[model samples]
Target: MILLDDVHKTFGSVHAVRGVTFEVPPGQIVGLLGPNGAGKTTTIRMSVGYFMPDRGRVVIDGHDTRESPEAARSRIGYMPEATPLYPEMRVADYLDFRGRLFAMDRSSRREATARVMDRCDLTQVAHRRIGVLSKGFRQRVGLAAALLHDPPVLVLDEPTNGLDPAQIREVRGLVKELAAKRTMLISSHILSEVERLCDRLIVVSGGRVRGDGTPERLAAAASQEREYVLEARFDTDESARGFEAAVASLSGVASCSSSEPLDGAWRRFRVSARADGADLRESLAAAARARDIPVRELHALTPSLERAFHALADAGEEANP
Candidate 1:
């Protein structure tokens, strides 16, 4: 639904986004994760056509953002980090105005406004002045405006920036609901929010994409060292070595080691995959059966997203410095 290919952006000497290239497919929610000043905002702006990339392409729903910006932008609903809204305008009135800006007809405007109001939970304050509404409501109003046109793609940057705990939870649920229908890209520093709502995550740092994949996949791919864990219905010293040598022969299996057995009945062994992304669970199970060793489970255990992200980001910093 969205693609950025070799995109680059600069502010004089500052390169805010460098060679960014990734894609968000239909029915998928991708998290754009980074710390402050990591070019996440800049990358989003470029994707939304607010700032043209210095090089490469930004395509939204098959329209090239640079070649046909209007068509591309019309397909997107953007809630910027700042969450700008007309303070004096009533919630309903503001959304109606936004719809009009999209050149929507009277009936279309009404229907769109109603749909987004319901989606963002703005109906309770439909007539309330945006300025008088609480910060949480104001954020909803902005979200409503963004949705007024019913765009197929949504780019939300810090959608929960200033909300209290309850408000944040509400907004997160709203975003999750929207994800069921739209292709969404969430750019937020809050890891838990991203982890909960997004199927995949892209970690950015120093104006570049340091890593991009599902959180679990990224964690596994980023690690140099590996762990092997095994489950078995039986455990014995000689039988263990028989299982170990059988496991080591499997493709990508490096080494299996464990001094003591787990729970005296189950044994846990760690095997380093000789190749990246190799799955050895099935091999281990088959080999154990061949030796009459009752096996239970075997799989590689990778670190968490937080741990993987820290490892990649720290390496990025060291390389740049």
Candidate 2:
């Protein structure tokens, strides 16, 4: 539904985006993840026609953003990180005004207002003043405004920022619910949130895409050897110490290095195991449990996106240094 071809942007001597290229399919949630100053915001702004790219092209649906801003924009709903809502307006009034901005007729405004309020879970506060609402409620009001036109695609920049734990969970759930109906491009600094919500991830650093794919794909692409990291808690300290010996004796495990004990009876260990190019989670769990060891948690300790990102970003830095 969205495409960027060799996009580039620069601010004086600094390149904000260096030859960015990607494609987003319909009805899929793609995460644009990176640390601060990674050109994610630049990419989104250029995609939405807020900032023209220095070179290359941006297409929204079938319309070129640069050539047909109106056609491209009509299909997109954007909610920026710092929500720009009219604090003086009532929540429902704000949505109605936004709908009008989209050229929605009176009847269309009413229907769009009702639909987005329900979508963003702001129906209860429809009559309340936006200035009087909490930060979380205000954020929802802004999202409702963005969705007032019922656009087919959404460009969200830190949609859950500054929210409390409960509020963050609420907003995250709402985003997932919205994703089912529209193509979403979410940009956030929270790794856990991206891991939980997005089906595909695009990790950017230093003006380039460092990693792009499913989590397992990135892990497998970066892993140089077969390795798994496991953690278990035993009945006592002695059981924890012997956990590595027990796992090391397994058929697949070639070596194990144990880490310091975690809180309670829990401890951590890294096992270099032979890979059969299959999922080894269940096998490792079963092996850990056989030695009277109560396995608390087990995960394939493949190299994470964080590791892959560091490798790529570091390479760029050294090359550009």
RMSD of each: 5.3, 4.6
| lDDT, model 2, position 115 | 89
User: Each prediction's Cα lDDT score?
Assistant: 0.83, 0.81
| RMSD after Cα superposition, model 1 | 5.3
Distance (Å) between predicted and true CA of 116, model 1? 1.6
Stretches of candidate 2 off by over 4 Å are: 229-256, 259-269, 272-303, 319-321
lDDT of 2 by residue, 1-321 (tens): 788899999999999999999988878888887667778899888877788888999999888988998999888989988887788899989888888778999999999898888877889999998989998888888788778887888888888887889878888888888888788888888777877888898877777887889866765666655777787776776776666677677776777887777887677888787655455567778877677576666766657766665565665555445
Error of 2 at 171 (Å): 3.0
- lDDT string, candidate 1, 248-289, tens digits: 777777787654677767777777766564577767677777
Q: Which stretches of candidate 1 lie over 4 Å from their true place?
A: 225-302
lDDT for model 2, please: 0.81
